[model samples]
Target: MASANATQSVYLDYAATTPTDPRVVEAMLPYFTEIYGNAHSGHRPGRRAEQAVEDARETVARILNCKPSEIVFTSGGTESVNLAIRGVTLSEKGDSAKHIVSSAIEHSAVLKTLEQMASTNGIEYTLLPVSQEAVVDPETLIPALQPNTALVSVMAANNEVGTIQPISALAAQAKARGVLMHTDAVQAAGQLPLDVQALGVDMLSLSAHKFYGPKGVGALYVRDGIRLTPSQTGGSHEEGQRAGTVNTPGVVGLAKALQLAYDEFDERTAHYRSLRDQLIDEVLRLVPNARLTGHSEQRLPGHASFLLDGLDGNTLIMHLDMKGLAASSASACKTGNPEPSSVLLAMGVPYETAFGSLRLTIGKDTTETDIEYSVSVLAQIVEKLYRLRQNYR
Candidate 1:
């Protein structure tokens, strides 16, 4: 049962960002106050900071099943993706290794970088189409591969609708033809079994904030033999692949958070799956002309998304906000895009339905009462929005 004086607003937008864990906070506090020195410095204080960074790297490497030297720390998922794509481009046999392949529903970080590279640097890219459920068939992607393709990038999970991709199979397929494979695993880091060896990807990216850690910290996993040119040229750092003073506190927080996530994976996953199922069932029962988005059973355990007729997602989200329920209409990164979702359009959803997208994701501590409250609140908001739209029509 919920406390009578408990919080009013339900945070159902974990896909956008999750609150930092308290254990992670405890782990980071020492780095900020006692060990406040740049990792680049060589003094005792700097060496302490550098040692903390290396410890964090080893922790992350343990989870990824990769060597500590293979992990490159960055600001976050966006910077990590930018580094991966650009680093590959710079290292590729110039002109000959100009082509790349990716999925259409990838995050803006991937899509935008590819666009910039293609337009400004003369790189060529092909985006494979997805099913209406926002999934890529390896067959579609394999056919688009070229002999000169430098890399093949795909997300482990779709941030908008939470569709899981077959990263292992896709990576195996891409590598068979000598192309390197990369996965934007930002959304899947804590939610899935993300063993790099099992996934077989040459590169992977993760953001700490997405899994209850501090913001402005993330890591990229580059396979042992794969070489990437430094994206940011500066003082040697991150094995000379990325350059900057390491963020000791944030990195420590990230490792602590990831450790907690793995330790509690089963229990947390069960809770999220139950709440997600409840959300889906209650919405379909209460709302008219509502259809679930993405693969019903294969999506992230915490993700619940839908499309409702005669409703715009932004408009619905506004009303939900007033009612103290938080949600999203599209990928959080593409919030202001008035156009229909690129992911939905790629999935072949009609413009009208795609325009009405709603995504609600639960987090590790989201209680049963919270899910109940959100479902009730969402039903009310959808009815209000439907009536308003009908009256206007």
Candidate 2:
């Protein structure tokens, strides 16, 4: 049963970011006040801080099934992706032409970094088309690889549409050709099993804030024996891969948050799937022309997205906001842009219809009552918008 005062707006934008878990906060408090020494310093307090950082690294490495030395801490997912792609380019040591292969629906962080590298460093890239459900076929990737290809970069899942990619198969293809692979696992980290050996990727990226940790901190997993040139240079830090004074509190929070998430993965994912299914079913049933986006099953358990005829998602989101319900029309990163979602466009949705994209994601604190309230509010908004359109016509 919902509380009598449960009229607060529902937060359905977990894909964008999540509130920090209290346990993670508790773990991070000591680092902020008492043990606030630089990890690079050699004093007693510094050694203690360094120990905390190393322990946190071990925790993250254990979760990702990689060596602690392979885990490189960065600002967040964007920097992690940038470091992986840029660092790989710098390490290739090739006089030959360098090329990269990636899917069309990648986040702006990946796409924009590729664009910048192409213009500045003379690195070439190919954006492969995906299926209508936004899945990249590994068969298509083989033909795109070249002898000079430095890396094959793809996301583990679609941030907007919630479509899961066949990462292991894609990684296998890359490895057979002697090409390195990297995946932005920011969206998939807490919700999916991310065993690095099983995934068979050379590198992967994750952001702490996406999985209920503090912002401004993330980790990149580089497989043992994989060499990446340092992206940030100054002092020797993060094994000389990233150079800076480390955020002891943020890293501690990241490790604690990931530990909690890993422990409750089964229960949390099951709950999300159930609520997600109900949210999808109820909205589709109660509203006309409500088309569910992404794969029906092979998607993140907590994610649901849709398109509606004769309705723009931005306008619908505004209406829902007025009704005490929060949601997104596309990637939160691209919010307020009147343009249609590139993810929907890549999925073969018509340009006009793509403007109607809506993404709703469940989180750890989301409940059945919240789902019920969200669906009811969404149905009402859609119906009213349609009626208004009919009258105007």
TM-score of 2: 0.97
lDDT of 2 by residue, 319-344 (tens): 88887788999899888898999999
Cα deviation at 185, candidate 1, in Å, is: 0.3
Against the hidden reference, what TM-scores do the models get?
A: 0.97, 0.97
Residues 285-375 of candidate 1 have per-residue lDDT tens digits of: 8767778999988799889998886588888888778877889998787677788888888999887778889999999888888877777
Please give me the total number of clashing residue pairs in predicted model 1. Answer: 0
Model 2 spans with C-alpha error above 4 angstroms: 1-7
Residue 364, model 2, lDDT: 84
**Clash statistics: count for each candidate:** 0, 0
Local accuracy by lDDT, each model: 0.88, 0.91
